[model samples]
Target: MHPTLAYKWQCVFIQVGKFANEVFLLLPPYLPILAGSLSLELQVLNLAAAIVLIAGKAFWLKSGRITPTDFLATLDAYIGGGTANQVRVAILEAFKDGIGGIGTDEWKEAFTQLVLDNQMQTAEPLEDREHP
Candidate 1:
């Protein structure tokens, strides 16, 4: 994998780790807890479990057991098809073009651009028959 690609994958996984930690921290022990009714014992147990699980997962992630190349290989396999390279190119170009990282709208436009650029569609746009 190229250095930039590897860096991007590492960044992606780091965000994943952050998200896991956030979710674990946010959830309460039980349904009643949301209503401000606390079971101290249950809360303690749930908090401990969450801490242990998050710690173990974080430890594994920081252990350096998995390299960026390995991750890229897995991702490439998951993406599949000859268009994997094309897709990557499209995404990189979109990023370069200043599309923000988050938001479905921007991503949708980027994908539409990719499709149009590739000439992937042959069909004409459908007309509204009643209006016609």
Candidate 2:
């Protein structure tokens, strides 16, 4: 992995770890105490549900798998306004090269330009289109 991407991944992992730690700290002993005092089975059940949900989400993130929709969205964000055929070919080439073929600075500039252009285009009046 490129140093920048590796750094980004590390930052994400750190954030996830902190979140999990905070969640775990809030549970367990507290649930037992609260459940015992209230004599409520529902509190225990809710705690169990929360644990399962958090565990499943953590497992999925650890698996390092990207969903198709996520991949498509990433591609669209990076390749906006490029010709479809060219985009397809570029994607293939990128996979073959095992590195991002575009320079990071260039990609950043293109993304910024695309966002600015989109904002301007959206702000244009519908009447302006007919005039052109």
The digit string of per-residue lDDT tens for model 2 on 1-132 reads: 899999999999987677656655544433443233322433433343334333433334436643333322322322232322232343333334332334577544543443333221111112211110
Model 2 segments beyond 4 Å from truth? 29-49, 52-132
> What digit string (tens of lDDT, one per residue) describes model 1 on residues 1-132?
999999999999998787556544444322232222224533343333323333333334446453333332322232232233444454455555445453478766665565445331212211221110
Clashes of each: 0, 0
The best candidate in terms of lDDT: 1
- Give the TM-scores of the predictions, in the order they appear: 0.24, 0.27
lDDT of 1: 0.41
Pairs that collide, model 1: none
CA lDDT of each candidate? 0.41, 0.38
TM-score of 1: 0.24
